[model samples]
Target chain A: MRTEKIETDVLIIGGGTAGCYAALTLASEAGGKRILIAEKANIRRSGCLAAGVNALNAYIIKGRTPQDYVEYAKKDAENIVREDLLLTMSEGLNRVTARLEELGLVILKNENGEYAARGNRNIKINGENIKPLLADAVRKCDNVQILNHVNMTDLLLADGRVCGAVGFHVDDSTVYEIHAGAVLCATGGAAGLYRPNNPGFSRHKMWYPPFNTGAGYAMGIQAGAEMTTFEMRFIALRCKDTIAPTGTIAQGVGAKQVNVFGQNYEKNYGITTSQRVYGTVEENRAGRGPCYLHTEGITGEQDKELLKAYLNMAPSQTLKWIEEEKNPSQKDVEIEGTEPYIVGGHTASGYWIDRERRTTLPGLYAAGDVAGGCPQKYVTGALVEGELAAKAIQKDLKESGADQGRYFAGQTAGNQAAAAIRGIYSHHLKKEPGPYSIDQVEEAMQKVMDQYAGGIGSGYRYNEKQLDLADEKITLLQKLAMDLKAEDMDDLLHIYEIKERLIVCRSLIAHLKARKETRWHSFGEHSDYPGKNKKYEKFVNSVLKDGRIQIIYRTLQKGDIEI
Target chain B: MSIRINKEKCVACGKCREVCPGNLIKIGVDKKAQIRHPKECWGCTSCVKECSVNAIEFFLGADIGGAGSWMLTKEEGDIRHWIIHKSDGSVKTIQINKKNSNQY
Candidate 1:
């Protein structure tokens, strides 16, 4: 394989929502600075917005204040949040929404010329091409370079600071050693960790992007970056087989959650996000299942609206309706909870970053879903975090007087990292096929997580004994993963993806065992503890030291708590 | 559900290959796009929208309530049509304007 070295002032990984926006912000604020975005897939249609979205889910409406949004998210997450991060992110929500509008996003406006509000904290938008718009803007910047089809494997560190990263092109034998003054990781969150609702050929049919295999989280964990709240997983309550979002019906048409007997049960448990999924699971366990969003008897106009709204984000649901020759007015939409995912956007489970978005490692900053402490940070919130991270990187680069020249001086460390990655890739290429294939090992890992680590098969519940088994089985899979072989660049990518998932699984199980309380119901249902404890209100943080997950607990940061 | 690419409709534009999130679609020696890993395909239909010639068709498998229907996309100026061919010799089309997508 050929090796290529790249030097930049700032390197942004995973050119999705946050990475593209961060590139735009950095290019606009600091011209002539070299900025590079390394994306595993093309930026035009990647990450969670590949198919697009129906609305800017996180926005400050006309009546609601930023503090009000923070309070809402804090309440939804049951007070285990970084209020400072949420407040900072909340304050910039509207600004980024307006920026998106200026950049050619179609935000719906009401008769008063105000942006249409979906709920208290969301604005309606035709966001099918949101990623393309952001990508187009970034492409126009002369100082930015986009490296598409490059899968980042690991971070490059000098001493204790993150100097750059190393990755390989997905379609070729070219390895890239990217060195930068500061690195901003926006790789999004992890999916496919647990066995999804659909199996076999439809395995990718889940809530989050199946391609986002928690590379950032795995790399950070390997580098010993502090991570928080991995136990607070995000389980989306979606339409039954299609796995399309239910929010379009619930919020757009005001549909209520009802059981098989058409009994409203959303309030029976709670209305919080986690509580919504928890109630669904509980109802199903109590044999009142086959839950649904009561969409029957809706007007034809509303049915048309729901169909078009789904086309903007998930067209499968719309297609399912069309194929069945049925509309929401005719039947209620069946809904179920997806396998749990570790995402910081909907639920906080990612890097433990400070207010400025700096991780524990120097020169390393995380934003978007990869950055923890902020839940419900949807499209607009990711954009805000990108902007926040860009501003912070610019300030840090200026204050530290670290330029491309000084960054290039760390080529020795970069060479060592590049060599280590090249060796790993070479080993994979040269190794003979072992007893387990990539799919076999991946399926085993998923089965272990599904049965023993609170996956949907277990109704999202687990005890200390189950977690211990999960830990043991996952460790064995990691060892088997080393003996796996790669046939081509495609196989190499799959191998790394599975490996990254295993690493995240290891850390997730550790966090699950550490958090003994059943604080968030189905999200973190520690059946051994069975009850929430005031003593366990602190954040459960972990850092990998000496090849072991070192658990650390820190008190909550309640910033400007006027609620 | 996976995708099937019709070589006759493919113009070898390479757009489908670039947009596939899984990188499952590749242009073969005949300069026609093909899905290398059909089983691994997530049926996201990103390639369908990017294909200007409607070369890629997503299978609506029976698992997800579809009775072996196939879906394709056709773009006409600012309007995009999602056409589905049902197994029972029926066709259904949904037209969406790119600009007025949020008119609701």
Candidate 2:
């Protein structure tokens, strides 16, 4: 009965690091035009920064080149990463890192005037928060209009390329096309695909923010963009279930991998080595195992020892600060539960783009954690990709003699992205009766994730049969996620978003299924085929095509770029 | 304009109404705090933080949030998010409780 259409020159899907940087990059150049940022939550409350991490890991300094960053990442990834994307990220890290203070963020400095960094990757600030700071900068910008709690339902395509996206306002329930000539998906990774140790908060321990859900890649796949390396998921291993690095006391803290004797057994099995991502996977493969999804080594006494250290060590930095803030304290922290699937970088589905963060479809871009490829899955990498994508777009538009400002949120005529959203929201799910509920559907999906998808003692231990079972359960969950009810427009969008995650999950499972010779060794954690092989599957990318996903192998020529 | 109360969120145990040093609120039968007319009501948000029901909302916009917060920028409020306590429930701040120097 009513028609609504609007357009923009560029559309960025996620409001995380990449999308925010892109918006900031555009801020100085473009004014008085249209730029619409549709975020699931407020932009400051985005992926990576949502839980307040203090640093960026992908920074490259004056002495360092992109080549060094690339080599470090490749070494960290055990030599299974794309050279071009990693190099591009590291080379551009300084641009993102240096601009934070310029944007009015008050970060702490040392006597040397350098920002505090840990693990030689992250930056530390005086304030114990990240999202609030990022949010403060974003709210001040004039060119951007943020629609928080808005979920992207579909993509608008013109002649088989991405033109824009269609999303629903979850808070009040209205739909907007959010059109732009070029689109970027910075939606971040999927931590919900597997069950994480942090249960009450949802399964997003260290992998990523919970709601990221691979929607960017879903947009890419739906728009028919080429995606790469979806299967190379990162699984962070920790001794305590604290997701460590968060600077908090665990329910218990001890070196992980205790033997049946209940002793510090990881060293005896020889797994405490550095730069070794897959040592544990190899151990489990040989059946010398901590072989548990939820096996943590910290006893109750150990938990008390670690928490007491935090409570008494540094009042400002310790549990006392949390206590003053009325946050949850270690009232006997849940040691690692019986299951352990800390799967990261696994939301393999996303807008397939180049090292420049340009999608295969020109004018459509992707960035942040949502942007596909590179040894991605960190804030710095996302920031680098975000900055690179913005530069590329800014350069392209400037060179083309095109006024990109005139094109913000433009018209879509049968623009398939809008039409798809129209069909899902206005047609398919809208016609259903009052009080349609997707809560039960989401709850059930979580239950399935906890039970079937290598979680809560449910994930297949890399066997053909278990993997096949995981596949069936995933398919069933996808159908349920789609057919589920929606009381409001946001629920439908969330349902649609769930459909995207299921796709990513299947792709992750497919890649996990395909890598017969486990190259990632310990961290990928699929121990059934756990022997490291350099010669067999050098570098593989999972590309979803024509209703089926295929893992094609391609190798870099020897002596291409020395580490 | 100042000290907005969500009646639905409030579970009137009179916690806020009781702790108000400024005597801004009084408990009503509806199980919510009734705000009396505010002329000299020095916008102390002590009652706001005291309410455990999460019924009270604070404002940063001075009139909306009130003048009470900026006025007391110097002193600690009557209520805090989490008051520190040694084994006994004595009111304490972040610094080691000098009163409870005997206790660990």
- For every prediction, compared with the true complex, DockQ reads 0.60, 0.04
Docking quality of model 1: it rates as medium
Q: Which predicted model would earn the best TM-score?
A: 1
For model 2, what is the alpha-carbon lDDT of residue A194? 56
Over the true interface, candidate 2 deviates by an RMSD, in Å, of 17.1
Tens digits of lDDT, candidate 2, B1-104? 13556799878887665444323465667767776523212223445545666666532222221222211011133211323333233443332211110100
TM-score of the A chain in candidate 1? 0.98
What is the two-chain DockQ of model 1? 0.60
Model 2 error, position A21 (Å): 1.2
**Which candidate number has the best lDDT?**
1
What lDDT does the true structure give each of the candidates? 0.89, 0.52
Which segments of model 2 are wrong by more than 4 Å?
A: A1-4, A31-33, A60-66, A106-108, A116-119, A198-207, A238-351, A399-417, A427-440, A443-453, A456-460, A522-528, A557-563, B1-104
Please provide, for model 2 over A381-477, each residue's C-alpha lDDT reduced to its tens digit, 9 standing for 90 to 100.
Answer: 6666767787777776666645455443334453544665666666535555434355555555555555544454432245556667778887887
Report the CAPRI category for model 2.
incorrect
Residue-pair clashes per candidate: 0, 31
Structural similarity to truth (TM-score) of each candidate: 0.98, 0.72
